[model samples]
Target chain A: MEKGGFCISTMASSNIAILLTIGVITVLVIQIIYIINRSRKPLHSKSPRSLSTLIVLGSGGHTAEMLNLLYVLQTERFKPRYYIAAATDNMSLQKAHVFEDSLLGKEAPEEVGRAEYMQIYRSREVGQSYITSVGTTLVAIAHALWLMIKIRPQVILCNGPGTCIPLCVIAFLFKVFGIRWSSIFYVESIARVRKLSLSGLLLYKLHMADQLFVQWPQLKEKYPRAHYVGRLM
Target chain B: MGDIDDIAKEKRVVFVTVGTTSFDALVRAVDTPEVKNELFKKGYTDILIQMGRGLYIPTKSTAENGSPALDYFTFSSSIADYLKSASLVISHAGSGSIFETLRLGKPLIVVVNEDLMDNHQSELAEELAERKHLYCARPQTLYKTISDMDPGSLVPYQPGDAKPVAELIYRYLGFPVD
Candidate 1:
C-alpha cells in the first residue's frame, strides 16, 4: 500500500508539471503575437504627404454632396492624395457611380461603379445610437481610427454626423503636427433653412470649428469664419 | 374580364413613399383631409404607400372597417416595375427617391423633411424645383403644390448643369489646379 501511494504521487506531480509547461507555452505564444502586431504596425505616426486631405460624408445627402465634390475633383488638376470615407448605408445613392477601390482613391472611372455592400454597411452605421450598443459603437470607432491612422490625411473635411463625428474624435486625438480640420454645409440662408430638431441645435453650437463653409452671405455675420462659398450643389 | 384585370385597367396607380426617419410624423402629415382629398381629386384610385427604411405602415386601413385607403408594400423588388407604370410618384425628398424619379422622367411631388436637423432636403428640393423638373412643398404647402402639378410638363434631367456643381466641389476640396 505504501509503495503504491508513492508511485501515485509521482504520477500526479508529472501530470502537473506537464500542465504547467503547456500553460507557460501558451503565455509565451500570446506574448509573441502581441509583440509582432505592435512591431508590424506602420511607423509613420503622422500624415505622410504634406497635402493629403480626408473627406468623410455621412450616409445620405452629405454623401451625395461629397459625390458631386468627388466628381469635380476628377476634372481638376490637383493631384493631392485624397481619402474619402463614406457612410456605408447611403451607398445606394452612389452605387451606380462609385466603387470601393475608387472611393479609397485606388482606381479609375471605368472601375468606379462597382460597389461592395459590406463597405456600405460599415460606413452607414456611423452616427447611429452608440450608447444603444456599446460593442458595435466601439467596433465602429476602431475601424474609423484604423483607416484614418493608416491614411494619415493632412486635413480632414466633414459634411455631417456619422463619419465626421468619429473622424473628428480620431483627428483630435492623434493628429501629429500639420493636419487641420474643416466643415461645410449647403444652406441658402439661415431663415431659408428649417432647423429640424436637436441635431440642428447641436450643429448651431459648433462654434470652435477651424472654419465653416455656408452658401448664404448672411451667415458670415453669425459665424464669421463661415466662408460664403456660394451654393455648392 | 376578371376583377384583378379590371382593377388593373381602371386603376391609375400611384405610389407614395416617405422617409423612414420620421415615419409616424410623415403619416400624420399625410393624414390631413387636404392631402387625402387631393389624392382622390387627382384621379388616383389604386395606391401603394411604401415607407422606406424605418417606418412600416401596419395596416392597409387606419382603423377597423375603414375602406382600404393605402396598400402597403413593406419591401418589394417590384417597386421599380410599379414606378414604370405609375402615373405619378409622391414621396419625401430623399435623394434615392428623387434620383429614381428623375431617372424615370416621371412627374413628382416631393415633401421635404421638415424634421431633419438641417432641413437638407429643402435645399435639394429647391434646387430640383428651380430647374422646373419637379414640384416641392412642405407639409403645410403640400396640398396646394400637388394640386398644381401638370404631368405633361415633366422633363428628364439634362446633364450639363451637373458639371458646375462638381467643379465647385473640386475647388472646395482643394484639388490641384491645372
Candidate 2:
C-alpha cells in the first residue's frame, strides 16, 4: 500500500510539471506573435495620427513632383501619413486635388499651410518677391525646431527650393540629436543664369542635398550627390 | 491671378499651367509665330488662359493662381473642384501634372520646359508624347501643336503600380514593408 501511494504521488507531480511546462511554452509563443504583429503594424497605429513625412512643396514644379511622390507613397507597402508645407502664394491646388481623389485607399496628405508659421520676410504681395518674410522665415525655423521635438519624422522628403534650406538645416540638426533623417530635392527643371540670384545661390547650395533627383543628366554634375531619377514627370 | 479667373468665367476656355519655372525657350518654340498662326488657323482656342510660369504670347494670358495655399484639410476639397472645371488642360512636363491630367482623362498638351540650364523636361515630354499618352510641343512649335491637337486627342492616362519613392523611404528607414 505504501509503495503504491508513493508511485501515485510521483506520477501526479510529473504530470503537474508537464502541464506547467506546456503552459509556459504556450505563453512564450503567444508573446512572440504579439511582438511580431506589433512590429508589423503601422508605426502610428497605436499613436495618434502623426506625420510620417514632412514634404515641403515649392511654388510650381516642385509641388507637382512632391505630389507625385505622395501618390507613390500612398500605394507603397508601408504607408505613412504626410503633411504639406507649401511655399507662400503657391497654388498647389491641383496636386492636392489628385491626392483627395485617389481610389487606392490612400488618404491625401494633410495640409499644414504657412499660416501658423510666420513668414520671415514681408512683401507687398504674395509671389511679388522670391524671398520669405522675416516672420515666415522665423516661423519656419521655429516650426522645424518644434517638429524635431514633437512630430519627429523618421525622414524628411523636401521637393521645393523655397523650403529646402530650412528643411536641410533642420534635418542636420535632427541627425545631431540622434534622430535619423534624409532629404530629397526635385530638379524639376534646370537653372538659368538670370534665375541665379542670391536666394538662387542659396537654393543651389541647398541642392547639395542628401539625395537629389534631377530630370536632366547635367544636373548630376552640378549636384554630385543627386541621382538622375529620369525626369520625375 | 485674379484677372485670369475673372476673364475665364466669360469665355469658352482652354486652361494652361506650364508650371513656375522659366522654360522660356520651349514656350517660345511652341508659341512661335508659325505655331500661334497655325493654332489660330485651327481655331483650337476660342479663349486661351495660361497659368503658372512661362513666357508665352498667348492670344490672351494671365497667371492663374495655383489656388491659395490652404491648410491640407480644406485644400483637399478645393483641388477636386479645379480639376473638374478645367476644360482642356495644357501643362508643363512635370510628372505630377501629367499624372493628374492623365488620371482625369483630360485633353492635355505638354510643352516641355527647355529654357532651363538643362533640357530634361523636353526629353521627358518627348518620351511621353512618343508613347501617345500626351502631345508634346516645343516653344517654337507651340502654335502648331495646339492647332493639330483635337480636344479628343487627349489620350487616356496609363499608370503602373510601383511605389519606388515610397519604397526608397521605407527601405532607408528599415521598415519591413516594400
* Predicted structure with the largest DockQ when compared to the true one: 1
For model 2 chain B, the run of ten residues with the poorest summed lDDT: B66-75
In terms of docking quality, model 2 is incorrect
lDDT of 1 by residue, B1-178 (tens): 6998987687766677774454555555565667666766877665666765645353464322222266665456435777788778877877656766767877888877666765666766786777788888777877787678777786677432234433343444444324
lDDT of 2 by residue, A1-233 (tens): 99999999999999999999998889766654553343233343332322355555555545656666666553333234344454354365445545645633343334321112212221223454446465565666776566555645544566545555655566655544436543333343332211232333454454334344454555556655545554344
Residue-level lDDT for A87 in candidate 1: 45
What does the lDDT read for residue A152 in candidate 1? 62
Report, for every candidate in turn, its global Cα lDDT versus the true structure. Answer: 0.54, 0.50
Instruction: For each candidate, report its DockQ versus the true two-chain complex.
Output: 0.08, 0.08
lDDT of 1 by residue, A1-233 (tens): 99999999999999999999998889766654543343223223342223445555455545655555555444213234344444445343343235344555755644333222223114335266756557766677888777766766545545554445666556644422225332233322222232322322343453223344454444556655445555444
Alpha-carbon runs more than 4 Å astray in model 1: A1-53, A75-97, A100-143, A155-157, A172-212, A215-224, A227-233, B1-11, B25-37, B53-70, B76-85, B93-105, B112-178
